[model samples]
Target: MVWNWQQTDWPEFRYDSAALASLEETFLLRAGELFGAFHHVNPNDRDTLRIELISDEALKTSEIEGEILNRDSVQSSLRQQMGLDSETRRILPEERGIAEMMVTLYRTYGDSLTHYGLFSWHKMVMAGHRDIQIVGGYREHDDPMQVVSGPIGREKVHFEAPPSNQIRAEMDAFIEWFNGSAPDGKSPRPALLRSGIAHLYFESIHPFEDGNGRIGRALSEKALAQNLGQPTLIALAYTIERNRKTYYEILERSNKSNEITNWLVYFAETILEAQANTLTRIEFYIAKARLYDRLRGKLNPRQKKALARMFREGVEGFKGGLSAENYIRITGASRATTTRDLQDLVDKGALTRTGERRHTRYWLANTQTDQSPIERRGV
Candidate 1:
């Protein structure tokens, strides 16, 4: 079956009152919940800190370009690109582009909304997957770009070429609107909605030779933080990856019908799902942190210092879970001193011994309760 490659008409996308109302209601409720989760500081229940940590983990996880571009390889390469450790690897020019893209996003946060910001994004998208057959280069040549897995897959395209000039102009217009929209006296577009719209439009434009999907997703974050002032905590990529087939289908459906309502709904629902998943992870981590805090009294000064270092740096052994080696490094003590502290900690029940000998590690003791054996032992 041949699928039609139709152009989008911006004028047709009017907000449906009922849909808008429903969206508003949902966002309001979500916003309130998010605010509480992020801002409410409970010393005994440090859920907000966990939420922050989980969000960072999600960002690192989602930054990788998986199977849509070799999932496993992309992740492995991306970690190298992050430049966090000392390891070095040779990168293809295209892969370098992806690396640069990850760096820009991670470092800049929401500031990547300016003209320069958009260009950097486009440059990386083009660089990352310039050789892919689906769409390559700014101009369409003798080879018609194939749209696989759609009603139009394997069909020869015989339509007016996408107007590059018009695309450039429309993109600029959107940027202009976005940069100054808050001051323009127009009722604010919801940040979540704006992110959805930006994704839909960028995909509709499909400007790059390849890697448009990843670039669009990256830009969606920019629109969220810049246009909406909210950093996206959910993994949109994770959700889309899970439903890759439906993802394309929904995007195609929106294009064919020029109806954004369904796309908006899908995008919003994915975000909500992602947020809910994040909430669960945060709660679990918070519980772990609370358990660690409760066990602090059982720890001596050196053990407490070791535990704090583990929490601050997230070292392998000290991640709310302590170990003898961690105690040695954290306290800057000799092996004998560290060993004595570890044993004392175990006796006080501030740490529990697991495994055996040098293989043994200490963990927060009695994580479920605030009681400490140190106080009981009068240590």
Candidate 2:
């Protein structure tokens, strides 16, 4: 028989604090470093990073549920949410809806979470999917809801949510606990731990007919933001999406076992990894910004556009540095023009070239060194 939270001493999750003690300290320290670094950056850089992070979160969270959304559309949606122009593209309803939900999580990170708030989020998630029979609220029927995989007949149910009748009571208790444990509430809980628990608890309940996974992750994001007293640049969903199999396995294990220590440990470690990744990205952003500053007004329009594309693509900017062919593709320049641009960049010392003929590639001259910004900062 599969064990569920409802049967395991309802509303009181047991976890070993000692098990998470060291991890919690490390996470808090790293989180502080990330937030501190973010604070020191210019407002433009900050906005750029926020757009990238939020866009990644929206995309990855949906990807976790096996839903693929257009990356450009999502970024456009996030730009609109930030009150910026949509860069010559009309906002798709789907993009607008998901962006609205993500913005709400960030904007109201510190607000008292309520059932109505969650309901609104659900509505946003389903805004563009009119064909789906499921509505934007709690399921009315009590049919068993299980996450399954494999062929239709040979499907395997990973886990089951609480019965429909139990959703209201379960959600009520969850909302009360969540609000009561806010930083200023009567029984304040550690923000990190509370986020992990909230995620697990919400998924276990599976209140809405659809979009539970996304909403649960959004809630986790909000919890982390609230804990940090500001919006976090880290996207936990990116890490989760990468380790999706392990994510599901841990959730299943936590649901089946009475002791949630293992789950907490896993969740904390995931957060640690997410924070570390965010720090590395921030360092990259700073490095790229500094590089642009140095190269400002030194390169022609084609060279500048090619360099900007390389920064946007990051590690995968090119298989090697960047080939003339790749430059042409990115900048829509003629072969002759592309070659001239590449040579101009090399001449200006903004890019370094290597290899012979088609094998030749170019890399940011200043970034030829292997050290990242974090290392340079001596962190």
Cα lDDT over the full model 1:
0.55
What TM-score would candidate 2 get against the native?
Answer: 0.90
TM-score of each: 0.58, 0.90
Which residues of candidate 2, in runs, are more than 4 Å off? 86-88, 319-321, 334-337, 347-349, 352-357, 365-379
Cα miss at 109, model 1 (Å)?
Answer: 5.1
- The 10-residue segment of model 1 with minimum total lDDT is 370-379
> Compared with the true structure, what per-residue lDDT tens digits does model 2 show for residues 257-346?
656777877887787778876776677777778878877878878777888878777533556678888888888999998888888888
Write model 1 residue lDDT over 172-236, tens digit each, in one string. 66566555433232545666676677787766666655566777787666665554355545445
What's the true lDDT of residue 152 in model 2? 81
Question: Each prediction's Cα lDDT score?
Answer: 0.55, 0.79
**Count of clashing pairs, candidate 2:** 0
